[model samples]
Target: MNDSEAVMKLILHGGNARSLAMEAIAHAKRGEIAAARTALSEAAEELHHAHQLQTSLIQAEASGEKTEITMLLIHAQDHLMNAMTVKDLAVEFVDLYERMRASKGVEA
Candidate 1:
């Protein structure tokens, strides 16, 4: 696949992961720990997929193939990186919530 297509796929995967991670946080806030964990797991999976695609693209470029950069491709890369960042932070957030729940003697 071309650079644009590869980047777009990363965008979608990353966006989905970000959205799901945020939703997981929201669910945890509402005292839905199980649902939150499930959402978080899904988020992680999506992020892994995005990361794989991005790694592939980087490897292709490293192998001496020329990559054209479009504004949309840049935007996609931005989205994917931002999503990965959010996902990392979300892991801490989820863990904090779990601790809080446990402190309150609530089963997760």
Candidate 2:
């Protein structure tokens, strides 16, 4: 794929990961532990795909292939980083919800 296309793919996957992480938080709020965990897993998968694309670009550069640094590429990187952070926070939120439920003698 072309550089722009690759960058766009990264952005898309990163955004998907972030969205799924948010969905996880919503599920957690409703005390749906299973659903929340599932969403978090899906987000991780999406992040994995984004990371693969990023690794390929880095590898290309390491092999002496010139890569154009564009605003879109930078934006894609931002999305990936933000998504990762959000996913981490979502996991913590899910765990917190589970703990809260447990403390109340409620099963999820």
The local distance difference test score of each candidate is: 0.87, 0.97
Candidate 2: pairs in clash: none
Per-residue C-alpha lDDT of model 2 across residues 1-108, encoded as one tens digit per residue: 777888999999999999999999999999999999999999999999999999999999999989999999999999999999999999999999999999999999
> After TM-score superposition, what is the CA distance of residue 88 in candidate 2 from its true location, in Å?
0.6
Model 1's lDDT to the true fold?
0.87
User: How does candidate 2 fare on TM-score?
Assistant: 0.98
In model 2, which regions exceed 4 Å deviation?
Answer: none
Number of the top candidate by lDDT?
A: 2
